[model samples]
Target: MPNPSSAVSRRTLVTAIGATAAAIATAPAAHAAAPSTTAAPSTPAPAAPGTQAARTVTVPATRARSAAGRAAAGVRTDFPIQYVGVSWDGPRRGGAIRLHHEETGPGSWQPIATGCAGGPDVAGTAAKAAPVSAALVPAGGAVGYDLRLPDGATNLRSTALDTTTGPARTTTLSPTTPVTFCGVEYLSRAAWGADESKRFKNGVENSPAKYYPLQTLTVHHTDTPNADPDPAATVRAIYEYHAITNDWGDIGYHFLIDEAGRIYEGRWSGDDGIPGHDANGNAVTAFHTAGFNSGNLGVALLGTLVNQEPTAKARRSLALVLALAARTHGLDPQAHVTFVNPVNGVTKPVDLISGHRDWLATDCPGGIMYGTLPALRAEVAAL
Candidate 1:
């Protein structure tokens, strides 16, 4: 459906009965820098000419019993890596284990940031065990991972994920064609291994995905680990947790931006969805806000921003995404706009690019990240 926001003459965008939206809303106008400017190795490859679709390979698990009886396992993947997550049977405790990775052979092992196995609190999935945070490894490189445990850490496991080289050359928009928005390239669901997203338990689903007219863009942070070795893996784990554990059926954000400035498609969108608009035209509706989700698009950074700021790459990518949203939706990035939650009949005034806190009384997109929204808006406006 054409987003009511985009279809200005159509009836005001409404969700449920008694919902009211403004009429004659005027269209308005609308990052960080990153180091090395290289795309994530697992940055979903765009479909190319004469190339087969990107394929997925699940590296076999390697497990060992330490001399002290602590469990340790490591696996290496040959293809470009996208997402990574771990499974362990245990309770939350003080002792910590480190998951390290080498971008290439014979290099120093760097620790990949991790989180609980159950997913992060920001997403509202309850934790079941202490699992390592997954990584979205940047740029296609020969990557290897090693899980190191102290004497007592046990019940540990890790998996290596490699997504498609890129999106399929053919989409509903074109056959053997390339697609891009703003100044950034987008990875398709297949590029990020959405097929690997954890399935809903018992095949049960929550309410069907909702749709709304594109209006506003909501910025968020996954609140997972920031120093991810393979952020794609962390994203996959989030997809799984949101689907299986939280029963949300899919990851909550419409797009995910890693520290490396890689943009991964979030919350699968169908063929009919709008390419540049928000949730309503985008096919996939998400749960990033409580009362106001339908018309808003969510672009989430990969890590916590409550204290620390996003990587330069992340900031740059966010600006591009918001620029696309603003231009496509006729929104002015620097202007404050009023939005009506079609679902709840509630209204809120927020910047075209808003922090999660603006919608709810929660510390979302983090205080540090939220504070940067003004600067981010300026970047979008410039774009």
Candidate 2:
């Protein structure tokens, strides 16, 4: 496992001082009492010179249904789905809900994901229904799940989705080809079924476009269901959540990646479907990291990965995007970078490519994936 302490120390430098140069300059006292050995590693092995084959893959759409019962709720489908997720509208009684799936036998199902209901948000934020999801390594032919419910619960309606189509690339990823040259689907808001009126109730003109020089690239996990059947719907749901629930006026990330490695353009850039560029000719900024939103590009992988690993296609696509970003921004993928957020003017010294956890006090990008950063950077460098 990757060490969180190292990440904590690195983040402490920026978080302790706030977003001002004056705060940073006057915060020597914050570091004076710290141990001298609390720093990230100085050097890492360089990636070997090599070329990977180019490939193409597609994730099939998912279908879903729901029902109420004490026994398993089996929803059959036409094909096998590699992932599954459940959104329940059960009785609002908070309790531990156990979720599981099986290949061929009854009661032989394996536990995949867990979620709790009725718990108060530490900040006492507004209450909302909790959704849970799980990834299936060996895609199942049918979709059927059972929920171990607590006593006196009723009206258990669930939105269960199964994706029969697993990710399979039609072309291999060649080290020489940048992802920009690859077939990236730059879907407009309508393509993903986003209601512009819902997102901008005050009127489109009220929420003007915001831009900043794109600097560091930060990766994050949606922290939602990775087993979504329809990636587009998942994207739309997130848009609503971010715009309405979080009141951010837009999806926070600049780009979204599905489990099959498909990339979607996020956060309206006002350049039609083309990516917006800054006056200096760099890519425009996105609202991904809070204090680091300015001058940064956020690319979020669409799944929670606290204990599970991302799919191979997802990782490859991530490398391709990161490489393209490095090439576009004149960055060395393996080099250390210093970024000053245009929003708060706070600075962070980080890897040319970094995880969201590196910038904030949160479990983002997850542990399994975060540990792969060094290798990911090396792969980008090679590309």
TM-score of each: 0.57, 0.54
Q: After superposition, how far is residue 127 of candidate 2 from its true place, in Å?
A: 26
Which 10-residue window of candidate 2 scores lowest in summed lDDT?
29-38
For candidate 2, write residues 193-221 as lDDT tens digits.
44455447656632346655456788888
lDDT of 1 by residue, 64-151 (tens): 1111122225555544444444444443233332333353354444454333122212223321222332222232333544555334
Give candidate 1 regions above 4 Å deviation. Answer: 1-183, 196-207, 272-283
Best by TM-score: 1
> Candidate 2 — what's its lDDT?
0.51
